[model samples]
Every structure is written in structure tokens, then in C-alpha cells.
Target: MNSGKSLKEFQEKLTTSRRIVALVGAGLSVSSGLPTFRGSQGLWKNFNMIDLATPDAFYIDPGLVWQFYSWRRYNALQARPNKGHVALAKLSELDGIEYITISQNVDGLQRRAGHNKDNLYEIHGSIFELRCTSFMCNFVAKDNFKHPLTPALQGTEQEYDVKSRKRSLHEEDASISPQFKPIKELSEEELPQCPVCKDGSLLRPGVVWFGEPLPLGPIDQVDNFIEDEDVDLVLVIGTSGTVYPANSYVDRIRAKGGSVAVFNTDIDQEILDGKVSKTWGFKGDAAVLLPLTLKPLIGEL
Candidate 1:
């Protein structure tokens, strides 16, 4: 379909729908000047994402993980939200729309753009958070400001540039940027105590990482929301839909007879063959597609 025609139809459906759920991906943040995690632009050349994100890495050396995360926190803090983020946040304020944002991205841009806490879910863990090391500790709070730690995590210094990696995917020997540092080392002095149990360690960011279970509570809540009501449509933006549980949720919504609208540069052609019925896939640059596509709807709302 032509871009103009496709955008128009998607707009029509959106304006008429009352219950809309948006499954957000890292692509949504691309225009905001941040790279998608584990993506073509997100892969770490020197270190495996598995090593950097898993419990084993943190256990083997919290300094490494903390250092890696510290850089991420600093970078995310510096980045600004683009049009897509602002558009989604605007949707939340619309009078007739019941918009629930299900974002796969760990970046907190969506929240920073002012999407309501209750209306959105960050399925992956956020970079802006730090929970207590003690699982028993209930000291969960938003943390973006912390001092740099020693022996910080390294993901290859290449995390800063978006162009070099995309242009030379095969030949790049990117190293973790040297400037990044760790937010904390979990030392006795810096660690915050659990709010519920004073002796317990404070809870950290609640993001789901590789080799870990996606938070059951949020997943279950999403499931119940999709199943109990007649959801009008699903807006999947900026995700490759490569991850398992998060990827699988799209089909669950489809099985219940919901139509999907995808905005991504990497959508699989086979999935867009209408197996899910009336599914729409807009290719290339989510920052460009999502804002233009949703503007017509958001404007009318």
C-alpha cells in the first residue's frame, strides 16, 4: 500500500477505537538519540549482552555491571525525547482513548515524556532505576543520580556513535567507551535499606533481563487487560519482536481477534501477510512513521 493510503486508514481506525494498547519497542526511542538495546545499533561488540545483563555478570563482578549501567544511566539522562515519545504521551491524555503502553524498551524516555505510571508498563528493566540487592528488600525507587563506581561495566566504547556501527556492521571492532562509569558498587555506605524491612537491601530497577523471567505481575496484568476486554487494536512500535515472551504476547492479542499496527524498520514480511487479520506494518524509521501515522489520530482525539 502507498504510504499516504496506509497512514490514512490506520488513522481512521485509531480515532474510532476506545480501547487501544501500544506495545512499544526500542525503535520508539531511536529518534530521541538513544540506541536500541541488543539491536543492530544496540549490540555490544566487545562484550556479550548476556554477560553484561545477566545475574552471573553482576555476581562475578558487580563493578563491571554497575559500571556498564552507570554509563547507560548517564547517557539516558542526557538524551531528550523525540516526537514519538511526545505523541504517545499525548495519547494518554485523550478524552475517549483507553491507551495502555506496553514498552519493551528499558530506556525511561516514555516515562520522561509524561506517560502516566498506571497506564504504561516497561516490560524490560529501566536504566534509570536501582533496586536493593537483597531480593527480600523492598526499597524500590527511581534512581538516576548516583556517583560513578570503580572497575565499571564496559560494553565497548562504540555505544556512543549510531553511524559507525550501522555503516560497518561486519567490520566494526567497537570497544566500550572509556568515559562511562558505574553508578554504585553496592557497598555498605551507598546501599539503601529496604523501606519495608529496615534490615533488607533496597530493591533496584525492576527491568527483566536476558535469562530472567519477565516480571510476572506486570505480564499477568497485561494478559488480563487484553483478555477481559475487547481491545480495539495493538500499536507495536520500534520493536523487532525478536524476544520470546514479549514477542509472544502480540500473538496472544491477535488470537483474541485484535488487529495490530506495527511501526518498525525490521518487521518480518511473513507476519504481515494478514495471518493475524488486518495487520499493518509500516517499514523504515519508527521515529518518522509513528509520529506521522499517529498524528492524524492524535490530532482528531
Candidate 2:
């Protein structure tokens, strides 16, 4: 917990800051019952996320890849935006502040929370979007939230409770395995095909895969904001600040004399103790912390 004085200082800075950026990550969605897609918690049907989130995996087994993404799509849809997301959305709506939320999540929770589209940048492409696989075909369908995208993907969404001992026991029995295995070998004809392409090429999720480059448009927008404006404050919410490019923003903002307030469950002790200059770390569930911390901006404090 942050001291009242420290929190007041942060609130004062937030209120007076001219340009603000909220860099969001997977941690923000964890409160909404979404997985971070890391370590044991990220395992789906005993398959590693690294194996399923790559272009090579999709090339070798598009059906399996699609099935994995279909399951994720279903789960993302089922999750409601948490208070953390709502807080950022509300912040984006506030007048007289140049605010932008650069979210790495493709789950669409920020949008669902009513964040302004113009100010919200989905740096990583969204799962709800679909694009043709063929390089020559320029086909894209945005905001396609239809679950079980194809009939072949029906009932493919299986929830595995990694923490449940009983579920683990059931999964050990091969005979008792879910009836969705044989469907993994679905042929291209049974998968999502591009409507615009005459040859009917497969359509994959618009999300950026492990080896793929991020969408240029969002990247450019964020870059323009960073380059054009004198950033005054940056809210590092629910992220470890490990990944590149997005992680680099903290240093960039700090270099420009901007203050940083991190909202996460696991923040560094140095940051929490105010040992780091111009940074404040509030350790806790961001869903709970954000609403309390940003209350002043909403006239609640």
C-alpha cells in the first residue's frame, strides 16, 4: 500500500499532467479471468503456448492453431472488463488531457470497457479480427466477434483447471479425453476461408504471432505521440516492463522528465519505497488499485 501523502502527490501530478499515456498489458486482463499465456497457467491441453503461438506451428497445423485461437477467442469473449479497464476507459474520456492507452492485449476488453477508439491503440492486433492467409490477398474483417468461427470449431473450447487436482486426474485418463481430438485434423475446406479471395484461402486471426511484426499503424501512432508531445505522466499498468518497444516507453518518458506510476500486483521493492526517482509503484490487483488511485480525476476523491 502507498502512503496517503505519496498517493496525494501522485494524484496532484496526474491532475496537472498535460500528456498522459497508459501502457497496458496482459496483467490487466488477468482480473477478468484471462490467462497471461505464460508458464504452467498458460498450458492448453498440455500444449505449450510457445508452440501454438508461432507461424511455424500454424503452417504445420493450421487446424490445431485455429483451434487454440478459437478457444482463446471464446474465453476472451466470456470475460467482462474489470475495473482497471474501466478506469483507463474513463481516463480516456476526460477532457483537457491528451490521453492515449497503448494496450498490448488483443482480447478487446478495453473497447468493451468503453475506451475511446481514437485514443485507444491496440498495438497488438485483435483476436476478433480475421485476415486472409495468402500474401497476395488483402482481405480483412475487423471486430468479427462470432465465436466458434466455423462449425468445425464447435465445442473445441475446453477449459482446463490447472489448479484443480480432480481435473488433473480426469485429464490423465486417456479414454476419458474430451471428444474434440479427432477434430484437430480438420481440413482446409472445413476451416474459415476468405470470402474476398477467389481461391478461398484460409483466414487466420488478426493477432500478431510470436514471430510477426506488430501492426504498423498502431506503432506509428504511438511513435508519433511519443515524438510529438512532451509526455508528462505515464501509467504503467499490470505489465512487467520486460517486452521490447512497449517496455522502452518507460525510459523514453522518464528521459523526457515524465513521472511513472506503476499499478501491478508484483512491483519492485525499490519502486514501492520511492527509491527510484520519478516513479511510484502501487502493489496490488490493478482492478482494485486503479479505481482508488485515479478517483481524483473522476472527482471522487
Backbone clashes for every candidate come to 20, 0
| Residue lDDT tens for model 2, 16-37 | 9989999998999999999897
Question: Native-vs-model 1 lDDT?
Answer: 0.68
Write down the TM-score of every candidate: 0.78, 0.92
User: Please, what are the lDDT tens digits per residue for candidate 1 over residues 53-125?
Assistant: 8877766765545556656676777788777887888887777777788888877888888887888877776
Error of 2 at 153 (Å): 0.6
Model 1 error, position 252 (Å)? 2.1
Q: Rate the local accuracy (lDDT) of all candidates.
A: 0.68, 0.88
All candidates: CA RMSD (Å) = 6.3, 3.8
The parts of candidate 1 lying over 4 Å away from their true place are 39-45, 143-205, 270-276
Worst 10 residues of 2 by lDDT: 159-168
